[model samples]
Target chain A: MDIDNISELIPQPVPLRDIDDSPGPCCMSFGFDLNPLIQSIEKVGLINPPLLKRDNQGSITIIIGYRRIKALKSLKADGAGCRILSGDDILPVECLLLNLYDNLAVRKLNDVEKGMVLARLIPWIKTLEIVEHYMPFLGLPSNRATLSSYLKIEEEMEVRVRESIACGQLSLRNAIMLLDIDSISRSSIIDLISNLKLTVNQQRQLIEYTVDLSHIQGRPIPDFLDDQSIKEINSDTRMNNPQKGRALIRYLRMKRYPSVSKAERKFKKMISRLNLGKTVKIDHSPSFESPYYRLEVLFKDGQSLREKLENFMREDIDSLRDPWKKKK
Target chain B: MDEGVQKYKSTKSILLQLKDIPVRAEKDDGPEEVACVSNELKRDMGKDTMHLVSYQGEFLKPCPGTKEYICCGYQILNVGTNCPLDCSYCILQTYFNRPNLRVHVNLEEQLGQVFQTIDSDPDKIFRVGTGEFTDSLALDPIIRWSETILRGFSERKNTVLELKTKTANTAGLLGSKYRDRIIVSWSLNSPFISCREEHGAVSLTRRLECARECQSEGFTIGFHFDPIIQHSNWMDEYRKTVDLMDKYIEPEGIIWMSLGSFRFMPALKPIIRRRHPETSILDGEFVLGLDGKMRYFKPIRMELYAFLNELLHQWHPDLGLYLCMESNEVWQESMGWRPETSEGLGNYLDERVRNFFG
Candidate 1:
């Protein structure tokens, strides 16, 4: 086929010929929509009309744009004149390829359709089949496994992605990440995503919250959690071996060395020195990058912040007023 | 009838006097009788306007295992409760302590606080909807709360308003200047469920007609099939609902639609058990969700989602459709897709609204 003079090569419609609608191997999938093509037709006046081919028996058949043909039927019903130019009016190979390329590019399959496509495409159908079926293998050849992974991503997401999509909170990226998370943590993943209004990194942190793997970007998970006690432990550990990144999940869970009093001393020292917010953020330190404790305080203004600090000092003084007897 | 029952029944104020009104039909009743009771109840109750007690602002803490707050999404204006239309599975029966159909009569102050919050974040888009804890438009005829919200939000670009209800009260909404900013959302159910589960509610066609009118008036419409119950012919019923929606409302005009399967707390089970003993909602197979709410099992949910999703995609291909609060695997299995990233969904939706209206 001549790449530029492709229009002359494509077979045009033989107006009086009968077309078969049987499920042929060459038949396009019905799951796709034709409205975009119809829209294109109404917009640019069918810039490249659908390519038609004549069977050995002299009947004209559509190699593609089954949806477009159907839409034209509907448009014709609404008094829009429909016509199929002669076989000589076939679209250029380059334009035809571009049209199909744009059509598939523009088309977005729903979750189920995506799943169905994935279930059929990546797992079963071979790459040669796609190449042979569509015949435009010029740019970014997509293999079955690659498409399958895309499908697998969809297959794996949290229920909230669907629910959020239904409720309008989730996006395609959000859905894929939700799928990457474990099923048990899916709801939590969605909740964290929507409620916290978390960033992508934070969302990933929440998804990794349950998983033991908390380290990301060479930073300890405790650093991500912003726990003060964990940071103190990290600093102590760093002095001994500068590059050794500690896993906070292990420290919090294992309770190695440092007795309860020692840990409490460390905690109090950190809390007193640092500004602990009204509500303390206590993370399980499930990974090296997470926190043992984080604090966030809300103050309307600088004055409010001063007042809150004063109120805290007054409470501290009030606690000091109570005399306690030393007992053994 | 006994004197007490008669006193509570005949005296419109007494019947309407519940702090948390429980409305489950003892038997199927006529719409006229319901209308008559609601009319008398409104008259005896006298005033029907928003009486916002207070803008209860509290730090909504997160729940266990989930970083998200199990929020009512938007703030609760607490306008009224116990809809005149008796929906069989009305959440109000157990959700509210008092359902005496109370409307917070103080609109100006409530609007003032709302404006304060909205003005607080000029750069941030604050979505404040009225139907979070109650039906926003059930008392629309008398209260006209949506009009007030529409009028208030018309000038504030930072805030988007949603008036969600099961009622087809669009008369108050028509010709509003804030039609673009205010999304007129409706809770839709299958005709079968509407007839059996919902009483005194307008017919499905009527609701769709109202939606069509709103859409034509340049208002973006939203449909919600929340508490999508499991029934033998639910697939056909939902398919019909989607079909009617496609026929009536313009596809591009739909801002969003939500699908939530029937879920209930353990506390609500007894209410349904006592009130709607014959309701088939509880009869279906169920399992406790991670949230501890009773929900239909995985397979049932998958079936429901698959059927409804296919119908919706076929009908309104571009319409924004999402499932409410479901897990990732279920989202993947039923819808065959998931969010690529969790952070962008809200922004994506906000952008959709901006593109449509802004």
Candidate 2:
């Protein structure tokens, strides 16, 4: 991993007009604002030279530091200092590598950008070297699977998704799950994640639920999600985002399994029928996952216990009767 | 087919002490099935590998129940930790941190303490079972657990030792004459779930046939549709199993039949996905239950139980049918009654015991 090959490209002042800002053959930068670059340059003067390439037309293109060049241009500087590659020496792969290496100092590459760059470098570089050296250097796991996923980030994902990745709002895993779904559902998921500020576990649950429900119902996730009832929760004005989220989850769960939802409604109704106040606690097992149910009644002494017992015994004990056991 | 004890490991010599059995020392580094790095090593897991490790924990623990449910007061006899038969929805896959088919050779010694504890409380019906952490009989061919435990409960007037299993490996039970208080139970699922989800277990017909054999031999048997999975035409599939049960089993000998829908810890979902990629068990709708396990929603659960309860009741009016780990409302809606508390459930089961054994 000798970096000395990049030293031959000497820094020289190139006229801002000579550098073509036209979209180059290998521009990976998207929507990167140069305000920080502009601010830094304005304070400390230009320190690091931008990596530029001179084409056969005798005009140099800003390969790596498009933001830096733009920042200099916005400051109305006539000339920009750049490490220039000239005359039949610069390969496109090297330009991609230099672009990747240049970002090593600027800012951390998000998974999407890292994926984009790794996608480019993997074609020519030996897979093992990239996995062992480049991947770890780029804060990625040194594995072919991870490298393959990052490679997919450039082509499978859209510009907005890439922006989501860059802003650290979307995870690569969610992005990958999103890719399996349609754009409409993907937007909905991304919206949920970004809006709800979904934790990692919640995001995973949401994605798995959405995908599995889609598979079961044979409907697109968003189509099922945008049902008439769920639409009300989504559009409800009285509820805050969290409340809406909770309500929508319950609605989605009900829609996903109609029988289970109905049972939940019935169980709640039964609980209300008990007429047990806050002191007289009654709760059923979670989804009947176990063989038993518990009834907890709070009492301080024998008097209270007897009272609670009386209340429980008096509350329509028909459901608790064993049909086979003879009455005394 | 006859089985052989080809390999063994133990922190004590209780397993090695068995005479006339050809027990060979395990030559592998140790049981590293969960952390094996190589693809071949991972594939080599569940490869007829058996370990007889010394168990350091309590041999008898209460069944893990949710505070909100009517958990049957079933006690677990910790004969082992992992099962030889790998069911797709088995909570043991997530319940255990270390992995392998490990038989606690110390179980024979611990049974003395367990029985002493049970004998001390003669009025309390300790409905103890050994299949909670492992199938009570799956490893019987290798470990011969029924031989060690049968006589201990042969005349225990207060307790009933249930040898619950899905395996047809019941030779150990058949050879013994101790039948005073032993219930050999089989966990039955629909044929679809049995064929698809329960790997390495004997088929439903064979399992019921084995139950028939045990029942004919003067052993009171039990049937458990403990993990009733919701599959396509599940009612038809389950009714097919019940039909076979009616054909093969005598209803009078069945002590109890428990119905439970498939429930699992959330952690098992990923493990199942990774370990069993071809499985369709996780394709159903699930929600996180109060106990942090993923369960089918209430309506779906009740629907399953209700259908089965009616069909089971139709088959036999007094099969001592009960729901395993269910709510009072579910019991009322599905089975027309509820235990309402762990003690009530225990009393109900004890009454079943008095009816069957008294």
TM-score per prediction, in order, is 0.44, 0.63
Model 1, residue B65: displacement in angstroms? Answer: 12
Candidate 1 RMSD to the correct structure: 28.9
Per-prediction DockQ comes to 0.01, 0.16
Instruction: Please give, for residues A1-328, the per-residue lDDT of candidate 2 as tens digits.
Output: 2235666666888899788876564555665777988999999989878878787888788777777788888999999778877637777777777777777876777676677677777668887788889999999878765776676667777777778877777777767666655677877777766776665655766787777777676678778766688668667899887777677666666666665566557666667777678888766556544445578888899999998898888897565322212344
Output per-candidate TM-scores for chain A, rounded to 2 decimals: 0.37, 0.73
Best by DockQ: 2
- Cα lDDT tens digits, model 1, B126-240, are 5556775567777776556655567767678876777887878778788456665778888898878988887667888888999899888888888888989877688888888
Question: Scored by Cα lDDT, where does model 2 land?
Answer: 0.76
Q: Candidate 1 docking category?
A: incorrect
Off by over 4 Å in 2: A1-35, A46-166, A171-206, A217-255, A259-328, B1-48, B274-280, B283-285
Please give, for residues B1-358, the per-residue lDDT of candidate 2 as tens digits: 0022232232333444555545566443433423223444333344354566656688878998978678888998888877878888887766433555777766676778989889999888888898888898887876777777889887888888999999999998999989888999999988898998889899998998899999999999998998888889999999999999999999988889899888888767766766675677877668777667777766677789999999998998999888888778788888988888878888988999988777
